[model samples]
Target: MSTLSTSLFYGGLGILVVGLLLPGWDTATLPRRAVKRRIYWGATLVALPVLFAAGWPDVQSSLAFTAMACVLMGGWAYFRTPNIKVGGRIITADPSHREPDPTPRGGGRP
Candidate 1:
């Protein structure tokens, strides 16, 4: 249990780092960047506390409260962030849809 929790904690930590670093990335456009930011940050918010709880059982109760707080806050922010367009696709709360085809129209398979 400890080993698994430790691994998860590190994984969540990596996600948090990626979330923190995304704003510095320059290539993504505004909409794509915003969507990515929300995703990584939201995941970090929800994952970190759970991992921490597992890794530190002595503080599990406190971490559980922290996790609930994170869930409420993260969920609110996740839904509140406005949808954005990346190329032709509108990225909404559900981003699982297929990405916009990157090829310029009338340019892909001729």
Candidate 2:
């Protein structure tokens, strides 16, 4: 991987770590969840180009790897994050949906 791609990969990895940890840092801070979710998505967004750049030697292989990475990461995110509700139903963290909840409701104490 080129220096740029490597940097991006590491940066993305760092963001992913932060995103994964944010929720544990605080439960009451909705902003933290938002930030974590943003970081996770941002890392995935950055990964696309980096994956292309990193795997440029073989376009097809690179694309495949990129797609796989996206799917796996997305799947992981979808099953991991707490407070994630799907299809109007609440689902606990399942190591599958790590992605932040998409809905924007319920940020304060009930």
Candidate 3:
């Protein structure tokens, strides 16, 4: 890879890694960000892969990008979806069933 392509690839990777490694990146445990925000991230990350795929030789370069896409999409999904999703739809606004429950539940007590 030429210096330019190398820089671009690493730059993209760095951007993705920084975004993913943020304090709350443990997607399974994170609260949903705004759907619009997720859309932006999803579009962005997905686009990056295509861009990188064009410049790089590996197909796996897109994996992280796709994973991030999933995370953002997931956030979008959970935005209004209460936790404990039953069947295939959101049925409750119980608040407690939501993610990142604002008030931390006491361990195995609450």
lDDT of each candidate versus the true structure: 0.53, 0.57, 0.47
User: In model 1, which runs have C-alpha deviations exceeding 4 angstroms?
Assistant: 23-33, 49-53, 56-110
- The top-ranked prediction according to lDDT is 2
Model 3 agreement with the true structure over 60-106: per-residue lDDT tens digits: 65455456556654564455334324453443445544443332222
Clash pairs of candidate 1? none
* TM values, all candidates: 0.37, 0.53, 0.34
| Models ranked on TM-score | 2, 1, 3
Count of backbone collisions in candidate 1: 0
lDDT of 3 at 46: 51
Worst lDDT 10-window in candidate 1: 101-110
- What TM-score does prediction 1 earn? 0.37
Q: Compared with the true structure, what per-residue lDDT tens digits does model 1 show for residues 2-36? A: 68666766676566556545552223333444456
RMSD of each: 8.6, 5.7, 10.2
> Candidate 3 overall Cα lDDT vs. reference?
0.47
